[model samples]
Target: MTFGGTVLPEWKQRDTRPGAHPLRQSGHGQRFGGPCVKGLWRRAVVVGLALTVAACGRGGVDAKRIAAADGAEWLTYGRTYDEQRFSPLAQVNKDTVGKLGVAWWAEFDTDRGQEATPLVADGVLYTTTAWSKVYAFDARTGKQLWKYDPKVPGEAGFNACCDVVNRGVALWKGRLYVGTIDGRLIALDARTGAVAWDVQTTDRTKPYTITGAPRVVKGKVLIGNGGAEYGVRGYVSAYDADSGKLAWRFYTTPNPKGAPDGAASDRVFRDKASATWSDGVWKESGGGGTVWDAITYDPKLDLVFIGVGNGAPWNHKLRSGGKGDNLFLSSIVALRPETGEYVWHYQTTPGESWDYTATQHIMLADLNIGGVERRVVMQAPKNGFFYVLDARTGALISADKYVPVDWAERIDLSTGRPVEAPSARYRDGGISQQASSPLGGHNWQPMAFSPREGLVYVPAMRNRGFYADALGFKFIPGAWNTGLTRAQAGPNTPSPKPATPPLATGELIAWDPVARKARWTLALPAAWTSGVLATEGGLVFHAAGNAFTAYDANDGKALWSYDAGANVIAPATTYAIDGEQYVALMVGVGGAPMGGDQPRRPGRLLVFKLGGTVKPPPYPAAVAMPPLDLAAATPSKGDADRGAALFGQFCGACHRIGGLLPVLPRSPAILDGEGFKAIVLDGALKANGMAPFRRYFDEAGAEDIRAFLLWQAKQPAPAPKPGGASHG
Candidate 1:
């Protein structure tokens, strides 16, 4: 069995840390001495953003509008700058929720993932779909006003580590801004859908893709990208809202050259961050700390909180020689929005290895703990820990496991560090972590906070990430370099089966952030689930499988349910137009995690209201897969075995049978070597997002992969993998 990092040649490590604690029992969690925090030393007053807005008119999205969390419109990504995602509107209360019905619907052309949260302003509803297309609708009648397409090159689809999905768009001073999946940030006239300005956010040559929604703060548009797993460095950028000029940039990882980048983050890297790393492929990969999603702004404290993602070539030793804390990877960092200056940072997973991104949703709140009022920033990260930090000082107020955590015993509050389990590093031998996997317990999906219920609603899951590394690990420039061998991901056992982390499952957790524990839990039925929406109506809205359900905020009782008739992975939003309140969400088959071969439904925006009586049209019939050739030569067992291994490495990511791209098992392109070479090794389908794999494998290897799929196609589909459980 290959221990992921330690088994590599030319590897050496030392435990310079003091609190390397032992592992804990399987599913339960224990807390250490978590100290109560004092007020922040520096309490900056709100500036730049005046608390003024015309909610009914075109006031545009400002701090005042976002912070108000008004009922008329969803002005920003999280409804408010605090990112609480809690709607103060209560028209559809528990008593009235039974009358909620679909008012109207709008459909799109693409079948890619639907994750964007719609924004409503001036009686117009604005949202985005897959491929960075933007749309506007009559908030009251669902009339399509205008739609704008960035026309992202189809081949740019290959650059996305996930599906080519756009979370949503941002509105600033009569202009709507969207960051394309191809890395272009463009601003458009909100009324006419005309282009105002467009700027390239990243070097188009690299594998960077923007999946997060842009946040406008103090006349600057803040945006981030995702591509860490594909070997790109991570950073958050700010642009002048009116001119599309570069405002500032804060790089999460240190510069590759070990010299000043002449950027805003250069000073911090030289003083503290640069030393935490040792020479390795990370320097080349920039060590991956992308602010892929979840950027929250606090006008009171004048800080922008950005959640940072995992490292490149994810195995710690493989990335950084198992060196220092790997400053900023899997960490929560607070920055000055105007200049992108670093204020303070809290590392969640030091020396992050399991793709445990601190880049999940971060919501800000004020809580009374032991009668002491403290302003806190909270997150339920992939590592399965619920962290509550003093928002201003970055001090840990308290931390506890909201889910089963086997990686570390608990967080030592005094040191602001986890008492990580000793064997977790796998330095001495191979081991499996029951709960913490690359698909974190809590992924990038946004969580909702209920000020009324005093609980944080989280979509939590337990996914077993196989940790054994490949035999002769090498970093590929634009590929998933997490160190797991293709054989490990296959159905066959690469190592002995692991225990404690049971089969994959998911639940909706109502956590008490102040008390640092789960208040209540609701077991969900789908392998895939949507982000949550909590409202003052004493109700919480969420989607599981195709059934969207509403639950009582105080208790976990199911209040009402609706049939969505398609998979929905985006969070729900609430708004009021012309005295009528509406709840809406985006629905379409998304990501491979919904298990393979989902129904083919067109992407759609669904709006609901009390007493509304409209039904979305049924989906078109699914196309059947063609049968395989009966006259083809039967492959020798050796040929098929080699094909399975190669397929696991090169093809399994998107081409699983009955999966996201369900045209693989009986693929016509693989019927002959000539066709296989063109489609697999050449750029025949590159426009369709299937980039030629010639960089990683040649024609012979592609033929072997073809043989493997033919073999899988001849039989019933294998049991669905747990990978789709939750990566949001």
Candidate 2:
């Protein structure tokens, strides 16, 4: 039977003898005594074969199957429960990598960042884009099979501290799980991309958001949230994979009233965590500690390791009266997967300030250390420390500084605590410059570990920050509660004089966990680049600026490179189909700190293999921003200050003074009040991904923002320092 305007060739039959008798024809149908019977039999056979193929295509990816994945498929965020992000397939190794070229490319509709790590399983490729849009494609070809958009409200953009981004999705039995930026966890049919179950994972009334990928452990989907800077308590929730029912929750911080939350973390909070806080202010500030990223499950140990975030107000004096270890903040906490009960924890940054979050990357491996094989959990947290801990007990095995940092002298191995520098806190109200800025030596980029080489490939950063207490700090609801003035915590400004030599750049570091030192370093053109991918083929791949390059796994030597026409902030994943291996990555810009200065471009999924020859579409040239005309407005400092605050609330997430987005002080549109209104209030630039903020700001507010931009334009440009700092 033909359906949907397409002919079903298999269903058609040819008759002999001029159709003398349908049953008498010399065909298989004749043996059945009628053409109708034959047709039904043939159809049944076809349907049976189709069902068999479909079943084979959707392999069951349970915990047991994932544990035995063997890198032939990209089954999870890190390809396995260990989150090693390493592949055993090595067909396209260092020798053949030089001939790698694009095999197929699929462009996305959105121009925002593409931070997803595509999951490849059963010959299907699944990934997510900005705004939590999920898609599935044929692994061998670039044919799109299905797509799912959660239809998140546009107004929800305000809740995101960074650009609206969804890290990726999780695959369970026959469902694909994703955490939306608006704080919803959704499960989709693996074949059809239809919503199977949907659950709101966070309080909608608060500013909580979810930009990380969901992880399924022991039949439950685990998800955490962001927005510690907006005054909400942080927690990680688990939902039943089949019914979407809340299984349990573990709050990362203590309650304000000292009452039990009646959740899995109640006892731990009441007994261990609550006392670590200085009651009054922490109760009010939610104490930060958002478990926004880096969740890994150890199937053997049955423990879930959650990497916690920084403090709420950042400044200790403001968040916790300048005291307290802040129990879970900036720490790696181990929890029971089934019950969400706290097991043990290791604090990476005690009394965490300076946005030194432990939520960078986590991997598990068995390593030979000091003449013994150790089961360890490895992490390169933001505070410039690389730590190895016993995954089962959460005991610190070794800690070392992987990057140059001045905040603390070193981590004391005896006590597993940092020996803080006296001047690191900036408590005396003077501007204190700190190495390894709040952006972190390493951020959300996933690192790769190669058991063959015994080295972890890290995307490392080098930057500095200036922290100072704000004048008259007061909590502002629905806004950044950093407790520091904008000038102090704002974008990085060049130092007038050198306290130390500048050190801001990006590099791919091959780190030896045993030796605690870098083996070799490959300098990147820019910081905040994409994650790393290690293959058994002796190749390591990474994306930076607009180029995706592959290097020798043992030594940092460039083997192949491709200019993808846009910045790639996502890691690359490799999978095999029909006995051939392929590497895939999403290309675009506009995440947290990078790509704001670069022109917004449509996102694309690019795949590569040896001798493949498909070219990516050319990206549009960046538009030259018009210069600001300060002669247009003469507003008072009070109006300018108000405008600055409004700008922070609205524009600061994407646009900084010298970052990727168009700098307001240099934009010629700000020279004309009407033009500025057209862009901001009337959506003149909506086509370019700048959504109209008419509902949030009126003409008066727009004018105030314009006045502030004009005031900023009159000031001298800060001198460029050797090192650069970008937002996370």
Report the Cα lDDT for candidate 2.
0.78
In order, how many clashes per candidate?
9, 7
lDDT of 1 by residue, 1-728 (tens): 12333341111111123421111111112211111111211111111011112322455656555554445578888888888888766657777788889999999988788899999877789999999999999888999999999989887877776688889999878899999989999999999999999999998888899989999999999999988877888999999999999999999999888778777899899899888998777977778888889899988899999999999877787788778888889999999999999999999999887889998999999999889988899999989999999999999998899878888999999998888887677432364554667767887778999888899999887666656655566777776676655432223434434554445677899999877788899887754578899987788998876778899988979989988877778899988754456898998755343443345567889999887899887775444444668457344232556677776655665565433564466556655667767877888888878778888876677776776666666667556555343433
Sequence-dependent TM-score of model 2:
0.87
lDDT of 2 by residue, 479-519 (tens): 67876555512122321343665456898999999998989
Listed in order, each prediction's TM-score against the native is: 0.88, 0.87
Relative to the unseen true structure, what is the C-alpha lDDT of residue 648 in candidate 1, on a scale of 0 to 100?
60
lDDT scores of the candidates, listed in order: 0.77, 0.78
As for candidate 2, its clashing pairs are 317-322, 593-727, 596-660, 596-661, 597-660, 597-661, 626-668
- lDDT of residue 87 for candidate 2: 79
